[model samples]
Target: MEEESMEEEGGGGCEAMMDDQNHNNWGAGGYGRHLLGPAAAPLGNSLLRGPAAGPTADPELSDVPEANGVLRGCEPGKGGAGAIAAAININASTSKFLMNVITIEDYKSTYWPKLDSAIDQLLTQSPGDYIPISYEQIYSCVYKCVCQQHSEQMYSDLIKKITNHLERVSKELQASPPDLYIERFNVALGQYMGALQSIVPLFIYMNKFYIETKLNRDLKDDLIKLFTEHVAEKHIYNLMPLLLEAQSTPFQITPSTMANIVKGLYTLRPEWVQMAPALFSKFIPNILPPAVESELQEYAAQDQKLQRELMQNGFDRGDQSRKRAGEELTYNGSSACASSRGYR
Candidate 1:
């Protein structure tokens, strides 16, 4: 690569100094204390720890490494001893210090492509025929990246790429004609679930450990967010009229084989449920008979004793009248919040 070619960077900022701030003890420590001059350092951005950071990876370097795994910085012939520094500040005394510098370019062209392909295989290949031969290799590469102290950035990038892929899928799902929108979207969700089930095994470490412990999120939940936003929310919004129809198959399959898309939404956390209070409201009228609704509406406007009587006679509509009487209607999946709820 050309000089000043290091163009991107990744990794979190962590500063825990061990007495030796500027001390370069290369000889005393097994790995030489090699702090290159600022002019020639390429991977220096990641290694240098500063004050704080937000929820993203570090900024990109100006001269990132090339795809062939070639390290091009201050060459020995060009910058003399300074060139040999490349981009690392080695100072380890106890264990065998092996400074493996991985530039963002290498991650993009090398590691990410292989991982992306593996994911493609997982999501596309038939589950019966899916083979995760590269699970070990991929895990090891990620393990190396973590050991090299680049886990945060790698984790962040993985989240982004997965979200992007899910977005593409959601768009395709949305393109379905109105007549078949929910039906086709259900099929897509089934496909996505099958793909997730078939492939998640390969990345057990990433799902269980890296995602939860390091990233502070459950793997299953994080992935489900993609569908929740793209498929669930959109389907409810775009296909509300159809979904609310009494003959709508998606709503009719409630107690048994719920539409996979809706079931998928049910599997999400309470926050998602809270955000969609009105989502369940649309189907309320469809579920209950008009007579039952009228009886409940009467109780809703009457005394507590009469309301209790209506409730005991199986006409117990929780707040349905208030809901119908221009109240701040909501659906919180509770018998008390509203009997028509509990769709979960």
Candidate 2:
């Protein structure tokens, strides 16, 4: 009975050992099966296929040192590392191609053609007739071109050309028939005067030397006339007191010279009539014959009355039309004055 019990215990121990071994083997086999579903199958097949047999073995499975080196390099972790590296290389190549495409699109759409066309157009139009060109047209073109080209030197040259053309045209117009030339001359004169008023103050403040040296006396006189014609009489009255003060000095102002200056200012500042009633009254008597003064007053009254009637009647006319009419009459009157002076 003792021997049988010992044998029975030995048998139980052997059975337990076998059961543990079988369990471990079964777990390992289950793990291998899971891996083989997708991951291990391909590697297993490659190993079974073996590398290559001879020199003329499949090119797809050649056995050269390089090939063996590649296989060894691609083994397990190293082989998987090669596949990852290949994927990274392909992504990098694709990213570079996309960047190149974006750069090309930007160049074609915005920068390249615009620059080329502007350069070509500027070259073509550089030498055309600039004198007959209207100020509005020239200024518009110049502004457009400068903004596009961003060329300071080119802008300066264009401005200089326009100014020089204006000067030459003004000189020519002065010698032509006064009746025919007056309207065009006035237009050009108005443009130059506006520019002078706006630009000259800045130039004087910043670079007085340029004005004194470069802006000629003729241009100065022309600008003065333009401004004087538009000044109000209130300004003239204010100016008169100052002029009287200046004249009261030891070197007295002559009546004739004062009259001429006052006449020019009167054309500019009609509002001066309200300010210096006594002075204007005294001056008018001394300057003109009584009959002529009476006639002038009558004519002025008639003009005002007519203008009021036109406005009240709803005539669609502007100040410019009125100014042009006055200018035409002045031209005619000046011709008569010249004729009378010739007789004298």
- Return the top candidate by TM-score: 1
Question: How high is the CA lDDT of each candidate model?
Answer: 0.49, 0.38
- Quote the lDDT for 113 in model 1: 72
What's the lDDT of the predicted structure labeled candidate 2?
0.38
lDDT of 1 at 231: 59
Which digits, one per residue and each the tens of the lDDT, describe model 1 over residues 1-344?
Answer: 11122222223211111113322333222123232233223333333332224311233333444323333442222322233334333324212233234466666666667677777766655436746555667655664444334556666776677677778877886777776776666666777777777445645545544566656887666667766776567666565465555233323434232344444555643344444444543333232234565476565564566556556657656554445433343433453466445335
Global Cα RMSD, each model: 16.0, 32.4
Off by over 4 Å in 1: 1-103, 125-133, 198-214, 246-259, 269-344
Those runs of model 2 whose alpha carbons end farther than 4 Å from true positions after fitting are: 1-167, 175-179, 201-344
Minimum summed lDDT over a 10-residue window in model 1 is located at 10-19
**Model 1: residue 87 alpha-carbon error in angstroms:** 21
